[model samples]
Target: MKREMIEDALIQPTILLVEPDDKVRPSLMDNLHSWGYTLIVALSETDAMQRVQGKGEPFDLLLMNQVGHSVAELVAIGRDICQHAGLPPSIPVVVMAECYGDDLEGQDVQMGDYEYVAYLEDGQQLKELLYLLCPVP
Candidate 1:
């Protein structure tokens, strides 16, 4: 019998983690790996975009920490990258921040939006969010 090829995405979910905080990056990296995700880490948004623009493995989800850019900006960047990569423009984006500005306070999630900001308190919180977004096959 002939065997069909399997895509990496079908085997394992790939996550593109864009976190600029030196202190926070390590833990996120560890947790993603422990969760059995194929991760590509970028310390900055530009770097993250560059990786997406290249011929590297396509990312399943974008777990980004709002550094210098706003949450909406990052989502747009993800979409733009997806367009360039010839993929569907429906990338799921999770924005992690210790806290949002006054305007965004008390809002944990934006219902029906493709991208939402969440408080990154601990790995457990992240894991729960990941479960909803990325399901390993």
Candidate 2:
């Protein structure tokens, strides 16, 4: 089936993307939008929270690129935002990182209501993770 046709079959799920880098946003947005996800790009934690709170509907998933800020900071802000919005902790979150080895010590990212996806890994791994999170119709 065609890509557009498949995307049309599923509900238009909203995705909150938190990435500081401007260069990566366009490509990521294009790829996700093609799959029928409504992308709300935020360059910082504050922007992300504002968009999430101000929006009419809560995002189906939150995707964060942990580059500019510390993981702890990101997790804390993310959790707080979700809590403030009265959203359950079970909401799926995908965190992108360079290295998510055993060294990172923090309950925020390690044992949270979200899932972790290593950004340094290959594209196939990322694709699989995304498929697992949001299956195609």
Clashing pairs in 1: none
Candidate 2's displacement at residue 87, Å, is 1.7
Tens-place lDDT per residue, model 1, 19-89, is 88899889879889888788988877678767767566688888888777766776676666666655665
Q: What is the C-alpha RMSD of each candidate to the true structure, in Å?
A: 3.4, 5.5
- TM-score, predicted candidate 2 vs. hidden true structure: 0.72
Best by lDDT: 1
